[model samples]
Target: MTSLTLVVFSLLAGLLLWQFYRLTVACRRANRVDWGRGWMNLLDGLNRLFCYRYHRLNVLGMRLPKQGPAIVVANHVSGLDPMLLLASARRPLRFIIAREEYQRYGLNWLFRAIGCIPVDREKKPEQALREALRCLRNGEVVALFPHGKIHLDSDPPRRIKAGAIRLSQITGAPIVPHHISGVRGEGGVISGVLLRSHARIKSTSPIYPEEWGREQLQALVQAVLDNKSEDLESIAN
Candidate 1:
């Protein structure tokens, strides 16, 4: 009886190890950004699972350049917005987040590790802009919610901040606009992730800063985010 029990235990352990190995491979394959750490890679995989499985995120017409710097601007609805963008992206993104959100308890370390640039809106906002410029100069992608905060469609109309357009003009990086919709928790941070919803990310063509005036660019970005642009397309699942 003892011998039989030992054999069963060994078999179970082997099976568990095999499954773990498979999971590791899958994570590695799905991870586009080389986080350079095993734990981060695992986290990235888990994020992908959360967005694709739990939230059922559908990415449509999203195209990023294979290399060089670019600015990704998305509409802010829920905290899940960033995760949805990250999961759909094929490159690492340095997010320009609010200072308070960047300093969130227990998440500050992760935010720093992911290269988030924190802006103190009331004080020294240019500090974050400088950092964003540095990242772009280094050929890194910088992402931001031009809306500045979590603004819902049902709320009063608000103009998007001009920082993203300014960044594009200065860095000469094309701005890629994406609109997020169908989030279950529209305003809550944790609730946005915890709740299940059929989320969709619709991306439009890249807007070149050199081709349009600042005002025009801002209006174009707003149209894309509002889903009022006629160029939006969806990819087949």
Candidate 2:
């Protein structure tokens, strides 16, 4: 099938899966279900079909905390990063998406099926942070893009927003640095010579308790971006 056909099929399949999850499978009834993990199994088939070839590197260190819950704070490189993580992470992950994106009827059900949490960028920031803490306290892994918005650059990433750091302090959940390396583009045709641009991702061996500070988060992300830049530069030369 053509790319358009594949995209249409994927959307239809996603919608049907979302409905199945809500009516017979979406997380519901506290203690009745793992709530955080209920929909993952249902989406396995769709993920295989739709998600492009993605490579995960250095995942050996990624792990579930033995005691409670934690946040997976990562750099945002592409729109497909969420699906890549969902297919790879053994634990169910809840994502923090903007409230406007969540309210749109077309996406709400599909996102809900995957257990994403919505934040109102225009409203109370503290309220969004609190909701994040609540999810962590309940033993759920939460994913947040610290960049807040996309920054296309070869330099170190833009300053990460404060919410991920503040939540680290509030919940004491270690901020595991998730780095998505090697994704880039703007005007190039989606097909063509971009073969090398396939997504390459890795989660740092979880940044430690004392290391969850904002400066620490910035340093870790910068280092990862630098390493990625060097690799690309070497390939060019």
lDDT (Cα, tens digit) per residue for candidate 2, span 58-138: 234355565567777766655655655664565667889888877877879878786678887777766667778889889
- Poorly placed runs, candidate 2 (over 4 Å): 1-40, 52-61, 155-157, 184-197, 211-214, 225-237
**lDDT on C-alpha atoms for all candidate structures:** 0.86, 0.60
Give the runs in model 1 whose Cα sits over 4 Å from its true position: 1-23, 59-61, 230-237
TM-score of 2: 0.66
lDDT of 1 at 107: 96
- Where is the poorest 10-residue window by lDDT in model 1? 228-237
- TM-score against truth, every candidate: 0.86, 0.66
| Top candidate by lDDT | 1
Question: Please, what's the RMSD in Å of model 2?
Answer: 9.8
